[model samples]
Target: MTATQFRCLLACLPDPLTARVVRLQRYVLVSLDCTGCQEVGVLLKLALLSARAGDLPAAETVLHLAERTLRALAGHDHTFAPPRITRLHRPRPRPARSAAAPSPGPALAGQVARWTGTRPLVAATDASWKRGHGGMGFLTTDGRWGIGDWKVGPQDPTGPSKIIITELRAVQLLLSTVEARVEMTVLIDSLPALSYLWRWQSGDVSALPPGYEAPHLRLLARRVADRPRLRFQHVKGHSGHLLNEAADSLAAIARRRAPGFDVEARASDLVDSFLTSWNQQISA
Candidate 1:
């Protein structure tokens, strides 16, 4: 049968079975002397199917093959550019919380106030991903900052991208350094990481997207839920935001496995200058 006819038949099968059949057929096609657009089409189809089946590594491998084929066809002309696929796994929609839920009691509020004190704190967090490793960084306006790294291993559950995991880790590390009762606002550059926190705040169990089952997520969710005074806001990355830029720099340094430095002692000069400029901009 022709390639189109074979694909049509494959579509008629169940999703799980179809993915298996397509993966098997991909191997057969690769073994043959097929080096044209037809092969690229088949490889792309297999990649999509693998993604749907929650096999991201298989999908990435297939996409690499498809790109290789396209490059071979384009030669030195550089006319045929491969399509970019950003997200392979889409998360299941979370159910909204009831609007009539009870608010925190006055006793709880008093306890939080006593624990956190009256002063408020603000911080920014950022993350970096390279190869199979990731870095997380956070810096507070009070000169308290930290940097850490995560190495994705074979047994680790790394969801869709290491960057997303690292972003959440940055927030987690930030929260760990501060008191839970402290009135604080954290700025995060990653929308997905902020969304996960928002969903967790709303009592959504599926805050972590599909294919992500990290144990730390549950603890993070619980910590966020307990801290009613803690807030999160989105900050645009690489937009001349001083605190965000500092956090990003720290994450990059951590990703390179560089030695840690004292932010208070080393970054005091730059931080003071940025804070002055930022305050002036806000006042104007």
Candidate 2:
């Protein structure tokens, strides 16, 4: 479907979850193939597009499938050729300063009233694309665990293998599942991912410069952010942490499943982060 029709059709769905995914099937995943970064581009676009259309549920479904498919193919020795970026349809490159965009999650109250037990289970995650690496987590200020996702891959720029594409897919998994809700802070190591999410959640897509993934990032946030409590924070990368390690492993595990549908919470300790978004929406 054309972008205009896709957006209009989604506006008619009503339910944030259902409309979001249906739009993904129509605009993002439907045209995606087993090729290169186009899949990544489509996945990223699916996310922001979902946000714009306010169909987060459907967006989450598509995001999960995209991430799973990307990781499943990550180990192959062959470099899957991707489509070239045509001047007619290319997006602006990400700014170098975007990397320095600090996360505001750390500034949060840090005293999540739910963590009265004294120990915060925090999970920090990272992902790479064309070496496009980014990370985040679900945790408490005291290092407690929660629901979150991350990945490492290449920069598709305009193709399917882009890292943000997988990140969005992972975000969908964290939000769409039945077990993802709870009170927790999600710490991400990637600035691009964090900035896009932060801006979108705050209701401002222009917060970051115009990048290919900007539109997708905004959609991803809108799809999940209307609800309060759920937050994204930036963390230092390559740090040694158990929950973070587990998230990386879980991402790969998710890929073994077909198209990332029917996926459930395997990392039970931190599924709470995922829940906060949906819960707030439900209550709203």
- Runs in model 1 deviating more than 4 A are 1-119, 259-273, 276-284
As for candidate 1, its clashing pairs are none
Q: Which number leads on TM-score?
A: 1
lDDT of 2 by residue, 1-284 (tens): 33433443344334654443443343242343335435644764565445433465656676676555555655421223343434432444533434344221110011234533532334344433322333322333342332222333364342543565555544543443212445545666667767667767777744533345434444546655664656777666556444444455444433332332232344333334533542355469
Residue 87, model 1, lDDT = 38
> Which run of 10 residues does model 2 get worst, by summed lDDT?
102-111
Candidate 1 lDDT by residue in tens digits, 146-223: 666677778887677567778987887677566667688899999988888898888774567668775666667777
Q: Superposing all C-alpha atoms, what RMSD in Å does each candidate have to the true structure?
A: 20.9, 16.1
TM-score of each: 0.53, 0.38
